[model samples]
Target: DQQVKQNSPSLSVQEGRISILNCDYTNSMFDYFLWYKKYPAEGPTFLISISSIKDKNEDGRFTVFLNKSAKHLSLHIVPSQPGDSAVYFCAALRGANSKLTFGKGITLSVRP
Candidate 1:
């Protein structure tokens, strides 16, 4: 059905702690994965991505791990900050088109 699912709508974390966000996909044809961070009203920005050939990818404070066998993935943010508080969307690409199928969105709140 090409559905990307983010079961949790929101998450909260304290400053300097680790924040974990999870996602799942039902489409076996998907080969690429991405995570985007968004602020209010604006489009999501590419954060990190993992290809089906790899199990994990990292970018500075953000890391994404993919488990193709289970069709699951997660994003991790370490030393979370107040500025990190924003909505995160999990997306997937089926082919070379580079277009993305998004989850409903998850709001991350980092308390100071």
Candidate 2:
């Protein structure tokens, strides 16, 4: 079974609108959660992250919320822009090794 899951295969949003992506995890030991945006030919770039100790974390237009009790997390983008279109991956890290476990990723298209 996959430890991390992104149920949505894709998401489409108009420019200046809001986009929401969801992620769920089965591992309770996961303490660090992160969101990464990847383009067609490049590697994923870090977006936002939240630690299990915090309920929410935000940076500019991106925000990440973590619910430890529910083993769920969500990423929200406000005023989505065309450049924001990419594949978003949810990742989790735990313990000293800090190995990352990533979700399947969701393709996001922001229309102008």
Candidate 3:
């Protein structure tokens, strides 16, 4: 499953605000680097990570929403805190080899 994640490499946000991140695989030709090679195709070993609708699944202060129709997904951090600063990643499932393609990390910076 190829996805468009539009989050920039760096994000700065004030604490206690909403932080939204997006990524797109269709642009910039970065897709090639994200691919992995695996031998012998097997059935999907595990189901997709669906927790809180693949999820618009939310955990505490973080919420993730996947929009299949728009070919994208977004991660929302509400009331963003300084401790939340970190690099984040996105992944795509390669059904042929039952492998996953992971996008590079996008750094998040929160200001207090």
Q: Which candidate is the best by TM-score?
A: 2
| Model 3 misplaced stretches (Cα beyond 4 Å) | 1-7, 26-55, 94-98
In candidate 1, what are the lDDT values of residues 20-109, reduced to their tens digit? 999999987888889999999898999999988999999999999999889999999998999999999999997867667999889999
Cα lDDT of candidate 3 equals 0.55
Q: Would you give me the overall lDDT of model 2?
A: 0.95
Residue-pair clash count for candidate 2: 0
Clashes in predicted model 3: 9
Ranking of predictions according to TM-score = 2, 1, 3
Arranged by lDDT with the best first, the candidates are 2, 1, 3
Instruction: Give the alpha carbon lDDT tens digit for every residue of 21-49 in model 2.
Output: 99999999887999999999999999988
Worst 10 residues of 1 by lDDT: 91-100
Query: How many angstroms is residue 106 displaced in model 2 relative to the true structure, after the best TM-score fit?
Result: 0.2
Query: Candidate 3: deviation at residue 48, Å?
Result: 11
User: How many backbone clashes does every candidate have?
Assistant: 0, 0, 9
